[model samples]
Target: MVEQGKEQETKDFHPAPVWLDESYLEPLLRDLKKDPGLRITELEIKPATAKGDNYASVMTRVKILFLRSSAKIPEIEYYIVKTTYENDPFASDIFSKYQVSTTEMLMYEKVLPQLSALIEETRQPEKVFAATLHVDYEHDAIIFEDLAVSKHVLADRLIGFDLEHTRLALRKLAKMHAAAAVLNERKPGILTKFDHGIFNRYTKGFAPFFENLCDVAADFAATCPELGDHYARKLRELRKRVMEYSARVYDPQPDEFNTLVHGDFWVNNVMMRYGERKEPLDMILIDFQFCSWSSPAVDLHYFFNTSVQKPIRYEHQEELVQYYHTVLVETLKDLKFGGYTPTLRQFVLQLERGGFFAVTVALTCQAILTNDQTADADFNALMKDDERGRNFRKVLYHNKTLQENLKYMLPRFDRSGLLDVID
Candidate 1:
């Protein structure tokens, strides 16, 4: 049976913590003071941009009072705190069932240092992707950094983009992939030590949930006669393929082109502040819970399918692929002593590999995309909403948007020799 607060329905649930309790705040303050004489006088928690199953997070602003020998010195204010929680939600019952929470804390203590070091080494101090773990072991709470103040980007808002913005963003992605690739090569043993058992455990239970969700979508579609058949057929196909597709696409083994991927690299996970009306000032990436070692193509394909608008995709698919490839090659050369660039033929081959994965991504994301509710809605709601119900009905009966996306994608893949590999 699910735990009271741990039900899947409450997965997206985040209750605000308006006031900071001294019992919880004291231990964390002690930890922060170990480095210096910073005393936190005020603590406030507000909603953060991301969410996960184990923890509810918020931005924390800390006002510090510093003791001074000099009269000129005054109180200092600084902001730093991160999502803090135990990993009890992730531990298996078979592992010390009675001491589950204790065991979870021990595991986090072991892993936290290595994870922190890796984040510090790879990312800029200001742009670190990994959350710092300020474990207040005594109180069972953690305090670290508030990412929103330093770096964060919104998901739903679409600002205008031109060719230059597209090129630079692709370059940044290439740099990320190259850095991961070099790390994997240089420290093969160390990198391999990080386990993906958590993903396997979470997704194993989630398979049945996804099937039920597809069924829910189909049931909703049935109420609308005109679109019912269409949605029913599409959901049926999705149900049949979901498991098989996941298995093939989620391989964790390392290859030359496989690197650390932002598994859900869509528009929402990326943040951009605009300079004027159309130009972007900076792009900040968030949500590292789904991040793992995977094919670089997965990240590239996801960005193309979900982030870029339809008009841009239809017109610029080939050019965009080439541009991303160019950046990837350049980045690898800089990161490695004598990294060899793929030939045009080899580049095209990699892009084909990306297209193969795109089929599964595009189909699954369609349920979220075309649904009337915001795409960011919880998975269960996406499955149950009536407008999505109507949309699914139309898809099942008429096969409109899915057909169009596939028709547009397949020709590009075929022309580029991707279909031959798929067949």
Candidate 2:
């Protein structure tokens, strides 16, 4: 009886490898074979590099050797398979929202192909707007062409994107935005087909954390007695607007200049390929899980406030905006889009609209972004998330990187009148 029990226990044990489901993989093989007409005679799956946000990721590098009926040489291709945590429901929910994976699926399958055709029609250079190999929405999984094989590398977020990188990213951004404008113009009801926005609700229960963070900011202000009252009043007023401002961009505005935003357009999501002279030649945007239809400014402010470092932001803020406008106008003209492009003053107004949201992120997320997050580790190295809420306020109080960024940003906010939160 004892031996039988042991055997039964052993039989019940089954390991879960979410990235290696045979049923989900057949479609990928079929898609791949359509071009080369070859079979993946053998393949192996192993873990690949991954990072943390909320997704409980199981990333696998798939190596495949193709078998052809009559081939001169055998070829090996590579792919990366990514999926949510199969074992942890709570973790999966935290990382993803109601239909985040499905949003990404639609972007890859429907939207990107249309964008690619536009790119070809307009006689543009590259299709850096999209990069997706295969997707399985039901499984909350995607397979990507191994970027390393294509000699592309993820830009470093800690150091931040320089001027050239900014231009490159923004140019591609403008092209996609141009496409969105034309498409929306043709059918007024089209943009609404996309999801509301990405990570817009990640700021849930932001009050407790914002209140605690205000106390921390007040303590810092006390050190400079001259600025104490100014900051104290600012923080107090800001506490009221934390949740409101963070929740502002969810719905689309019919009257405004709404365009699709790669909602999480930041340094890390951009991949670059350097030329012979060691300069960035081309770039590709990845991770459309946060794609949304909103003011084009949402993406603009996101890139400016999160990715661009202090020097570039201080020196070239206006210049960069102008440069982006120039590219956007040119691309729109190329597409035979006759609609009115927003003027420089109008663009600045959009920046002001997104400023509060930008400030909130800078105050709450710098530490998380600056930390050395390895594959096994996450952004919450110094903080944690639980039922009560995220411990971001504690990080604001103690984290050096967060403190330094706030110091840099607060003065700029005051100068620009962005801290006039009461109005």
Candidate 3:
């Protein structure tokens, strides 16, 4: 939620967070003071500027005041607070379960640290993840160092990233996956706690967001009735096929080549850093809410299909896929992985099985992209008009990017036999 115009002068928060309020604030401050390193004096909380975030996000901005001394530290520290409340109305009706939320904090508290250690031990230049400051067991909230204030800037979801951006992102992804593999190899069973895939859980229990996306795709395809019939028919049928088959996306037979996947890997979830020449420099992946165990191709197909546009994809699909596989193999081997890398054939099959997810993600992402209702709506504004918090089903059917990709990808997916209903 975008917090604007609600910055109060005192500790009395404007529409205080559901779990964190004045009562919790004082003690939380006290807890920090327990550490000799942190002699905090005051705190200021407000809504952070959230635009084009997940529909279920409830973010808060915190300003920490430290006691000034010879410690020679910056007096103010800023944090971005992320929480998924159990009783959130939208979360309840749409994405009711937040097992993903718990796992994300776990990943930060445990998984990511191990991964970072491996990266440093292996002397890898690529950075896999971001930094987290604090997490509350009771409030279901996590505080992260505010990267926004630094060279890091949010990736524009509407425009998406280009080839250079894609390569760097893939390298980072490989490092992360390899770290997990090595962590499991060294300790054995460290990642078991996150064995349940978040996408799998949501696909099974929540509303079929895919159907709504297919509905929009069908409508978008109907723009040219003659040429659109195949796409429209394919899309309409895809609605049913998607729900029934998508659950298997999380499953790979007998755990052949499973690794932890960043379930929500797309342009929006990444924050890109830029060099002075305006070239892509580095990135930090955010919104860890959906991290879980799955095939590496799950992340690959998602970014390649939805984020990479058709022209670039058509030109470089095989090369790009090979690049990702090569990096994954090299990174894992460097860390002395006990298991051999998945065969290229197996990776291709993973892409084939998981390609359907890209289709739905393409639809849902473009829907939210085209939908203006909340795209630009501010936090306080949504609070004032609760109707602004509607689902992505205001489904904008005529989105140009959506149409262009579908015209090309829908047929490709059909040819690859990814969409079972079409055949």
Per-prediction TM-score, please?
0.64, 0.81, 0.84
Off by over 4 Å in 3: 1-42, 49-51, 68-74, 85-87, 93-98, 195-198, 201-203, 369-395
- Compared with the true structure, model 2 gives a TM-score of 0.81
Listed per candidate, the RMSD to the true structure in angstroms reads 8.1, 6.5, 4.8
- Pick the lDDT winner: 3
- In model 2, which runs have C-alpha deviations exceeding 4 angstroms? 1-27, 35-41, 52-59, 69-73, 94-98, 199-233, 249-251, 373-401
lDDT score, candidate 2: 0.65
Q: Is candidate 1 or candidate 3 better by TM-score?
A: 3
State the C-alpha lDDT per candidate: 0.48, 0.65, 0.66
- In model 2, how large is the Cα lDDT of residue 363? 56
Q: How far is 13's C-alpha from truth in model 3 (Å)?
A: 16
Model 3 poorest ten-residue lDDT run? 7-16
User: How well does candidate 1 match the true structure in TM-score terms?
Assistant: 0.64
lDDT of 3 by residue, 1-423 (tens): 235434331222223376665455545554654643445567677765355455455667777777544456547767778776455555443343547667778887777877887887664655667787678867777877777667788666667778898888888887788778778778876774564454564435443455655665777777754347777777788777675565567664554677778877877777888989889888888777667667776687677765665655779777778788888887787788987478778777767667777676665655654343444332222222233322334325445666666667777777776655633
> Cα lDDT for residue 91, model 2?
48
What are the runs in model 1 whose C-alpha is more than 4 Å off?
Answer: 1-13, 17-37, 50-165, 193-203, 208-235, 252-256, 276-278, 337-341, 354-356, 369-376, 379-423
Ranking by lDDT: 3, 2, 1
